[model samples]
Target: MTGQPLDAGTIAELPKVLLHDHLDGGVRPSTLLELSDAQGLVLPADDAEGLASWFVTSAAAGSLEAYLATFDRTLAVMQSADALRRIAREAVEDLAADGVVYAEQRYAPELHVSGGLEPQQVVDAVTEGVEEGVAAAAGAGRRIRVAQVLTAMRTGGNAADVARLALENRLRGVLGFDLAGAEAGHPPSRHAAAFRTLRYASFPVTVHAGEAAGAGSVAEALHIAGAIRIGHGVHVIDDVVLGEPTEDDPWGVEKARFGDIAHWVRDQQVPLEVCPTSNVHTGATPSIAQHPVTPLLRLGFAVTVNTDNRLMSGTSLTQELAALVEHAGWTRDDLRDVTLTAAWNGFIHHDERAELVEDVIIPGFTERSNGRHRA
Candidate 1:
């Protein structure tokens, strides 16, 4: 294959890694509609397309504030244990069909107890759903492994409660911890005690910073919370500056200056979970074409592409990667590099992560681009 943008079909068939998907946010339109109706929940739109369009428009209101409000509908329906189970199982099925070989999906359990369930109940339901989903994928001739990342709403209370819940279930498919929800006023340092607890437990953490706020939030997430990865570290690009160059360096390749926080993220190879469509919806970036995915990749940053919310942003990992190739001018080999980076940064056992990078990921990309070869 030449160094051109791959079509949607080709992108859909390649093995993919997704690190930032939200479990409740990725529900299918039809499923959401049906679930709402079953629970006697009224919606603004009657048909599935109309409801989906409503969500996309609402989430695209040019501010992270409005974008996050779109979750109110989805979260309301996830109150019951059964509802959580069904959505999670279906999410994994959808991921497998979309060529997601491995995924780390996150959701806040605190959002699910309004219907009279305990915190641990929500975790168990989600864990069971993940197991069923993996089995469903295998029965369909695809093997997919999924890990749950429990999210603690920054605007809500008692993050240490959520952190303890995630640690309790870590032996049961719960892999990591996150601080999601509104990022404006709720700095990660607000939950310093929870981070300290998780750190003592040696659990991997990914904080949602630098998307709604600036580099300061990212710094707190790293230093205070001990974040191994970031959810949408887009604003770190603000610290970068490189005016045009002259002479033999006509490529405009001056040093891309970074702040102390940015320097640590880059030098430590802390992965950034970038969602192109979601970023555009929240006005985090201008256009999908202008997303920093490829620039960070070429600059030696461990950048991995993701779909923050398939329902809200209306995208998959394959679609995100395809957009990068089409609009960002990335090559097929570049896609492979990003996939490997995601697998490495994934919150999983070291042996399992290594197996994915060595066995499944590299071989699938090799087969897709160059076809079968001699031994």
Candidate 2:
């Protein structure tokens, strides 16, 4: 894969797979304004551009707790079934426009019950919206697949119930389960029973760990909570010990030694749903250039790039990849590798994942490069 660095336009045309996107966090600013107006709720900004800028500024508060506070506004208008359905449908449409071939939308159903909605009703509304979004995208000549991953807030007390909801809807559209929220005081181990239930039922689980905390948080997510994938697991790099660079290797990655947790993560090929821009905004990492995604990828840690929250970060998957190419000196091969990693690690069944990689992702990249690289 040798040529000029891929620009954002080229990256936007490549088929990509997303594994870690928040439904509430990705609501369109214009939609938010409309919903808030219908509810007679005051907002910091009156227009879409200002509202979008406000979210980006608020999310860059340099702490997970402060960064998460911006969601109060998004969640404020997302209480009713109609709002959830609209937001979910628009999310799929936006991703399709951005050239995402597959995506898994995640949100905590318990958060939407304040408007007198049952958890099952919330799921039904979102599922309906996803179906509609898929059909709409297909009509517009954009083929995409969207699935749901039911999330349980780590600080909330209803994780067990969320797990049950995921199992009940597995055949419908729910593909997996997740635990998200403040990762410091609320560890994944706190919801042991929820993990136990999901594990006993042979369900896939991904835990948000090693973001606000360190590698210890990642260990608990993997060992105690039985997560097959780690969300924002950048801090797993904390356990690595960097050694001196050798004459043959200037980057020193060959000399870097991994601790027990890091070794296990790499050895078992546990997928890391890394959000580069979101990590910078939340102070999880310093910047895109210094992000551990590159190093971890070089060390064979199964690193996959994602847009954790598209609106909050003021970004899309294309922009995320372009940033790596511009600031991190990433090449076309790096982009392909991460896209393939994400496709293979998606929550769907093994055969479906293979079809996505073989039929969609590889062909898209191959055609774009004009046979410059072989998959």
Candidate 3:
């Protein structure tokens, strides 16, 4: 039931769930310019549009390390409570305007402490910002839910501290814990203590894997680190070997094969937060069409679409969905399915998840789908 590509209006009206966004990575360009000025920092581009282009182009350098280098500029400006709070609030407002009903935004508190602020202080500031943004969005007639996901840098040695902080603040809007950084040499096992802590506390965990590395990284994330979800587990495709169809089987029912890792991921129904544009920007795949998400979805692996970094990828949830609709021939049903997958896999409570599925996602997509049909 493939439908026509989603238009901007319909895309903007569709309710979405974002499970893998980065708070620091999605700062508003205009806000960055202002923050940079306040900090007396020099920016590569003078204007917001130019800075936006610069970020997109630099991220498109086709390597994770090169892509991460762009964060130096953003991180530099995000050292103070005011900057963090303002950016975090802006993130919530922007997501709400783009029709995101719920989001789990992640960032490393340790990265923001260079300005003589403590880790808890940084978290407190961002949380207050998110709360303020949510209230402001409500006053603007947009209802949205957002939670912070405290992230531990895989290259750093503070995973345990980060994990403990996340646990300590879970009641205050910190929904989960995650590991993010350069993924090649720094494996999830490097943060085993943090994952162990989360596991002991029964907290949710997601780790970036298979984006910069391969199936082994994902395997460690699942087996060693006990991650409930995988961030860009695209390279799990590397473990899959598609078989050939025969005359006896016209439908190719037995033509697809999976290695143990892929089989485990699929059988376990571990959600893959697939960020298409960002995957392309990081060279995880050559293009949107070549991304493993469609194949994984068809094979019954739990898959959810996300915009990993709105600024870096120059995308929104709407843009990410539109890209898949245009390039992958995804129908509106496919979009709904991925939204449901994300809502289900979100780090929020089960009752809230059910409420979102019933009260927002399902009904919102249904309305849009019906409107398209009537038109």
Best by TM-score: 2
- Candidate 2 clash figure, as a count: 0
Q: How does candidate 2 fare on TM-score?
A: 0.97
* For model 2, the run of ten residues with the poorest summed lDDT: 366-375
Candidate 2 ranges beyond 4 A from true positions: 1-4, 245-250, 371-375
Query: Candidate 2 at residue 33, lDDT?
Result: 98
* Whole-structure CA lDDT of model 2: 0.91
Candidate 1, lDDT over the whole model: 0.86
User: Candidate 3: deviation at residue 212, Å?
Assistant: 1.0
Q: What is the per-residue lDDT of model 3 for residues 1-375, given as tens digits with 9 covering 90 to 100?
A: 235567766878889899999998999999999989987899999999999999999999999988899999899999999999999999999999999999999999999999999999999999999999999999888889999999999999999999999999999999899899888778777777888888999999999999989998999989988999999999988888755646654323356788999999999999999999999998889988767887788778899999999999999999999888888777887888899999998999999999999998887877777774211
What TM-score does prediction 3 earn?
0.95
TM for every model, in the order presented, reads 0.95, 0.97, 0.95
Q: Distance from true position, residue 175, model 1, in Å?
A: 0.7
Span of ten consecutive residues with least summed lDDT in model 1: 245-254
What are the lDDT scores of the predictions, listed in order?
0.86, 0.91, 0.89
Q: After superposition, how far is residue 365 of candidate 2 from its true place, in Å?
A: 0.5
Between the candidate structures 1 and 2, which one is better when assessed by lDDT? 2
lDDT of 3: 0.89
Q: List candidate 1 segments past 4 Å from native.
A: 2-4, 245-254, 372-375
Query: Compared with the true structure, what per-residue lDDT tens digits does model 2 show for residues 136-187?
Result: 9999999899989999998899999999999999999999999999987887
